[model samples]
Target: MSQFDAQILVAAFELSYNDWTLGLRKSNMQVDVLLQNEVLRRGSSILEQTASSLSILPAENADIEGSNLSLRYDDGALLILGEMSYFDLEGLFVDTDSFYLTTGYRFGQWLPHITYARLNSTDDDIRRAPRIETIKNNLPAGSADQIAVATVQSLAPILWNQESTSYAIGVNYFFSPQVVGKLEAKMVTDRNGTISQFQNANTSGASAPVIPDDNRILIYGLSVDVVF
Candidate 1:
């Protein structure tokens, strides 16, 4: 329905990204700004329908507020097909995205296509702030701030999303006009933060500094064709 959303609540502190077309052999540009994170992806494919009729298409994309995983699939209209995803604002994340452009022609037992795209996602933080709850000193009363403490650093919600893409230049090969095969690849990343609300004019526990792990995955695939 809507291309871009102003504020993504159910998911906060997000990152955005972009991708390219399959048949597109040229470069392109995109404009978008996010507060926390960003991501980019690309991909491509080819198919032949007939001797005289052929289809070639190249595409690209951009994502915003991509702190976590972002999965969007559009059928023909939005340059996507189908997708599934999971995101978190509290821990490391794995995500991905993609776009495909197709042009096909009928040529007796042949159909072809050309596509292009790119992808990228990196290490992210799940916990943004550290916390400690204060308690009465039963052992030895220290400073007013160091009496009894409970850790609440992970109060921040974990956000998750993804980005991916692909592209094809010139030389290609395929068989069957119906269902031959398919190719695919995608990348994932995320960001972290802590949202704290005091309980009893309360205090919080000291949290260990969180270090994000690298989740940039590469996807490769093969495609098949069939004519019926």
Candidate 2:
């Protein structure tokens, strides 16, 4: 679901589920296209820097266009999914393209899944950090440049080119034909990568870029599904 409201002018829209499914000897394949928006909520940390001495940055809206192709084998015993998504930015630094691949296997009620994803910038100038030349051109004032620089200096989470892998183990319990509950624990590994950042030296017309740290996170979640 999505709504486009700019300057109090309101327009609403919803997406319908549409896909083409083909049945094979032992598997089913499906494909679909999606047009959506990744609406960045105001005050999101991705847009705002948390460094005590830096200024706050505003979040920008992104238009996402993507498609998904998936296959399921033996009534959900095994599954594979792949997707390619492109993000168009509004008043942000650069556009990005992403690719994702996922596979899952189910043994009785236990399901294990793994996913790989990569994000790359379309704007070559924004390899590690937003280009100062781009900033100066997009925002032509001294004040705007200062804010942009400060925003980068604050180390906001900007998705530069990076690759990550995640693994999850879960089980599904069916309460009825139309209802189910699922529990899963997932761990994600983010390798060392360079994201766009601002440096005080850059303010003085020098080059300064920041390299992000490698990290990992584990998440546990439970979810319920119901169908009418």
Candidate 3:
């Protein structure tokens, strides 16, 4: 048996005077796992026996909470935006703290902007997996339990334990009040020797473990938006 429940609340305010406008927004969310099946507990042998039948491992009884706040200011020609967010995932994933900021100016139908953003894991040391050799050396050689424990420990760090910073520049062209086109270029740099959400494309094979590569990535995006 498994049970889950969640609640969310949002509040926003806006004030406008002539050509200047200011706004604030806040949100909070909480999730509670009321019940969990016995078979789903960590280190349960049922998962190995029935691995093919299960597609997901549900969280045990835990509380997951998050909140965010944002402030914005926009005049007829200039705009500024900022936001901060945090999450406590209760070990379902790595807890995270993030921030974002943007500044933009409008000229006729064209709006150009610059943005800076950062995301950091608050519990990186706890989530990082121990090396396989370290785990094996401490355990009895060729023990049946050795392989099982080693595999799990080696894969733990793959669970979103990284930090990154991003810088972006973009332009939005307003075709009308309801339509817009955007072009953006962004660069993401890894921090603290951690791989920030990027997977290695050169995996050896299914039998090989996929590792995170420490490298910077550049992204280019073009898109159009239409509002009904």
Candidate 4:
């Protein structure tokens, strides 16, 4: 079978509840609600598999509800934002949620921002079984021992009771009203970081290699944005 494909659509509603100024500072709050629906082609092959698959895949048809709020002070000089998103994949008996919070401070045309994000998934079994077929088909043909071990490693399913936290700090400079440049550094910390299933190196009743279970990753990025 071929790899799956997905089509997604999103709609949103927004409202500004308050916009006021006290003394020299300006403050406003706005909220938005979003709905997302997606359809997957050949989704069952990946989503309905037994604990035998090695990846956690999304269901063929899924729905997500999300909302976000933003509060601004002194025009864009200082701002705070919060967002929450929830997913319901009843077909696969899975549920997931995520949260994001951000705050920014501006000094003239230069802005510094900090953000935190977290993701939580329920139903670990549904989280770990979608990629076995792809891996099996992609393995090289000449290495028999390697392929055998790889197949066995992928056949075992791992639990998906995992949570991840990400932290980011960035500086943005507004070159003009229509253009901005940014540089950012981010780190992600994952608890129970196993995203793929693999067998243990020690068959003496020890667990699979725990080295990859918890991970901390650092990333740095630079980008420019232009509004036309």
Of the candidates shown, which would achieve the greatest TM-score relative to the real structure? Answer: 3
TM-score, structure 4 vs. true: 0.55
Candidate 1 residue 46 Cα shift, in angstroms, is 48
lDDT of candidate 1 over 131-191, digit per residue (tens): 1111222223453222211111122122222233444422123454345544544332322
Clash counts per candidate, in order, are: 109, 2, 0, 3
The TM-score that candidate 3 achieves is 0.69
Mark the regions of model 4 whose C-alpha exceeds 4 Å error after superposition: 1-11, 20-74, 90-95, 127-162, 196-214
lDDT pick, better of 3 and 4:
3
What TM-score does each of the candidates earn?
0.24, 0.47, 0.69, 0.55
For model 2, residues 101-207, the per-residue Cα lDDT tens digits are 66677666555666666655665343234443343345535564445554453333343334445566666776776887888886656534534221221333433
The lDDT of each candidate is 0.27, 0.44, 0.64, 0.51
- Write the residue-wise lDDT of candidate 3 on 1-228 in tens digits: 446676776777777776555566655555554335332233223222333111122233344556676777787689888888887665424678999999999999999999999999887664442433454466677665566545444444563566889999999999999999999999888665565665443466674335445467788999999999
Which pairs clash inside model 4? Answer: 55-130, 56-127, 193-213
What RMSD does each model have against the real structure? 20.5, 12.0, 6.6, 11.4
